[model samples]
Target: MRSECPVRAVASGSGGRRSYLVTGYEEARLALGDARLSKDTAAFFAGVDSKRRLHPAVAHTMLAGDPPRHTRLRKLVTGAFTSGAVAGLRPFITRLTDELLDRWPADGPVDLVADLAVPLPVMVICELLGVPETDRPQVQRWSAELFAAGEPGRTDAASYAVAEYMTGLIASKRLRPGDSLLDRLIAARDGEDHLDEDELVSLAVLLLVAGHETTTHFLGNAALALLRHPAAMERLRSAPDSLPQALDELLRFDAPVSTSTFRFTTEAITLGGTEIPAGVPVLVALGAANRDPRRFPAPDRLDLDRDATGHLSFGHGIHRCVGAPLAKAEAHIALRAILTRFPRIRLAVPDERLVWRHTRLVRGLDSLPVLT
Candidate 1:
């Protein structure tokens, strides 16, 4: 409620986990960049042995990390994310999009979630990471387990499965290497930085999961938003050149992430006129921040021509998603190709009947049925 106060302390109903929710646009952006914030989230798992706690296999700390460590971990992989590198993926992404669409049901309702939105991103990421075709299904299952609303034990099991898989994958890469992203990361790991085996696995896991999951949500949510707004959809279908800006608007209108990753303050800090004590967990609501009327007039309306550049879809600061370029390229190719192939696409079912995958971290449709 930025209208009343930007920052409000809230408690979860499930775990009763206390967190500060920052809902204002400017406050959310600034809070994300606050130096007093620390990503070392082990403090959340209060009673467990810190060594045995959840240690993600990407970016060293998943979404948490401050400083030179975050700098070093991110730098090792930044070389391959240049504009040219991501642009180079255009042809591959286009080819994959066409191939996937070719297999879509030609005569009846099409479930975009299963047929296109889900598999396409996973396939692209799999190929990029050199994950074998046979193993893709298992990887997808593990990824779903981590994101889906489920019991804690089930999610933990899924996390362990993914970590163990990545650990083995990294070990194999050390003996026999290729030019894939995983191979490059392995080389960096073994290089002068002395990146440990665990960190190597973490990075791979992060890449494989984050690389496609958010993009999957972006694809699904963007499509649904476009379908709901026929004027914008028709405009993009006719003038595909403007699809990039349209995608940006779509992301802002309905951000893929509901909230930013947890950030705990290292010291007392004032945010949005609210003083947060040291070590309080913070949840920056990206979805709410994007819709702030102060920043975006008529925040509920989708305007393809609106200047939505500053939207937090890719986040801001060093913690911003490293795969933003790749994600944008993939979404662009996916949307453009869809428009060209299915110019008459529309929702197959009533909008009210659609169900959402309402997880704590991800916001996406369970299935998006469309007709062409």
Candidate 2:
């Protein structure tokens, strides 16, 4: 599709909106960073004043926003994820990885999603936000709802449940402070800058939701890629330092995020010689872009040694994931440890039996059962 038609009109999204999808590498790369594209959906949603229509708390996330608002929200929370701050988590993350691996079932089909991938990031983000271990299951359940495509009511209920929980959590943090990221956010001061009540809750939920969900998919996809490609796996095992670059190739080969989040043009934009009119929704196929043969040779095959530097797994432009470093650190350490510990790890079931997430928003395994 990318080679034949880089940009084409599609009638696939919900709410009866005209949509456009871009699949070429250069097209998606440029569109993601395009100023003409806006993330605010007020102009598209039906029957209400976009300005006065109070979007859901989770909707306040900066990933779905444009500048100024994005700038301010990003600034308020940027310090918590600085390279130094994220790197500071290495020891704790390493310890956690070892602990989880040690607990894996000795002689059975272990669901790696439940055993490692899911829990690893969930625990990390929870700890970062000072969420209790006891509350992990509940938060995990609610967070899973974000991927419940075609089930608006379910996702809504899930969002509300998290919002209610965070309200209490925030109130408690206000009373009894701790040295967690939540505490930092609660008291995060940038001269005269700070988060209001809504912003605080929104940011917390965003971090918790995005913090684990994307990373979980990434870990799953990357693990599956390496497992299917033993040469790549063995190479990483012999030289663990190569795991970093190998991760990039794995990401490009199978991006966790199949499509970039909702983007709409403010004015008619021409891309790939296709005329996209104003107010049309645009979905950039990140996974497709990563595999564009015009850009990366042998794009479908997994080449751990490939220089996959400019992959869109973390996205492009200012809207790029802020927790990218932390996610990479988690994936890097987790994958290395998994491969190192279970040198003979392989899927319990045939590849054809595996199921993928039904939603197009994310590309990941529904469950990855493995024999460690």
lDDT of 2 at 86: 91
Per-residue lDDT of model 2, residues 220-272, tens digit only: 99999987888888988999988887778888999999999889999998998
> Model 2's lDDT to the true fold?
0.87
Where is model 2 more than 4 Å wrong at Cα? Answer: 13-16, 46-55, 189-191
Query: How accurate locally, in lDDT, is each candidate?
Result: 0.84, 0.87
Indicate the TM-score of model 1: 0.95
What are the per-residue Cα lDDT tens digits for candidate 1 across 1-372?
Answer: 779988998985456767799999999999878778888765554564542324355324556666777787888777677788887778888998999899877764889888888888888888888898899988998888778575666676788888889888877877889889999988877788777777778778888888889999999999999889888888888899998877778889889889888788889999988998887788899999999999999999998889998999888888988888888888899988888888889999999999999787778999999997
Candidate 1 ranges beyond 4 A from true positions: 13-17, 43-62
